[model samples]
Target: MAGTIQRHPVSPVSALRLFFVAGWRSNLALFRWMRPSAFIPTLIGVPALQLIFFVHLGRYLDTQPVSYYALGNALHACAMAGLFAPAMSLAGERFAGTLPALLATPANRTLMFAGRTVTAVLVGCSSTVVMLILGSVLTDFRLPAEGIVPISAAILVTAASCSAFGLLVGAAGLRTREAILLGNLVLYLMLLVCGINIPRESLPDGLRLIGEIMPMTHGIAAARQAFTGSGPVTGLLLVELGKGLSFLVLAVLTLRFLERGSRRAASLDEV
Candidate 1:
């Protein structure tokens, strides 16, 4: 009794505040170890390097490689980051022994989970802006003045959609320890099938069919349209937003289901 640690019940208001704070701190912790040199290389440099590679490679084959790669890769970075961050958060919470408490809290699960995911969505959006700025600087390409509004809107939708999908992945992650691996797998799958480097039509028929259901497929097209000042196809943006909503609904249901099972098994603390 003397050595026992006292644990106080967290008030709903306090839990909500901590929920948002945890999201911010978790995202910050992700980059804390990486000094600018290392962090920049991964976050900004890799995409810039990829842009350069495509620019040079396109020189031999085409006159407008920047047009092809700049927007695509920028959007790719944003989509992937948004898509994985929440999932990684779930895995981290599990490993840290905080997930069960968070999930089991009397607080509204939807509000709590959404609060925790906001930073990741913002990270995704900021990454998109950074990649676009970097790509423009490193190449002849530039963001069109007229396209700015449309592009910004498209970026927001892409980030939102990917964040929802990531939340779904996080919910599923409650059942397994491999959430991070699942996140990476989804990221690469999107890269290949979402037309990041190649046209979606160029994909094999089977993969193309699969790509249609992927989170960022329509969002990427909207991104390209935004770059051209053609206006984001409203249908595409709607589809992306719809997909995100559907994923969020699915995540909520999955989390509820898993919670039921965990309660029966009395294994909420199990990682």
Candidate 2:
């Protein structure tokens, strides 16, 4: 046994702690929106302004009730936190010159990256709540007492789903510098196709199909139904959860694949 070392496996509780600690540190390091100057405008001011714009636009068009736009845009605002934050978190490691060090660690790649989603989901849910409150105060948006629980659940699920999708974009950032650009592209694409501003029924068949498979569509529908207390929300929530899981799987796989390729090619530090 001379000169040999034995390593004990980490306990479950310790593993959990490591997961959270790594995630928190990753968020602190990579997610710049945590700063007051960035946080205020990104999470609060931007979403609030977006809600106001859409609410007034809907009023001018006189197409749908104010609640419709309010709920839709509020749900969409969650993406600002859920999507952009996580994408930046992973992609930023490369830009910060930490990717090589990160890869050199003995941590579980999946858990480390997935843990980043925890803060993203929390921030996203906060953004959703803020948008909802602004909608209620500034517009005719109202959530029935019975609908509150379901709407809250929908918001949480939708935020998680958006965070998962963001991880996928971050995975791509391992290979290229366009992760943030891709995140913006997907965000606006969802805005148009995910029934945020316009009805999916009005979109062409191709765009409608795209929206169907995307993250926010079902969550937005579930929230709207919850807002009105018109129908059962279980199905929509389940579908939204499924979509999140799918994106999470894809992101993990993509991260692993890229990590291996970079190691083989000695390119982890290349950018």
Q: What does candidate 2's lDDT look like per residue over 60-139, in tens digits?
A: 89999999999999999889878888899877888888988887766677777888889989988998898999999997
lDDT of each: 0.75, 0.89
Candidate 1 has an lDDT of: 0.75
Q: Which candidate tops TM-score?
A: 2
- State the lDDT of candidate 1 residue by residue for 47-159, as single tens digits: 56765676566656674556767787777776556766777677777777877677654566666676656876776788778878777777778877877877788788888
Winner by lDDT: 2
List runs of model 1 lying over 4 Å from the truth: 1-22, 25-42, 58-60, 63-65, 230-232
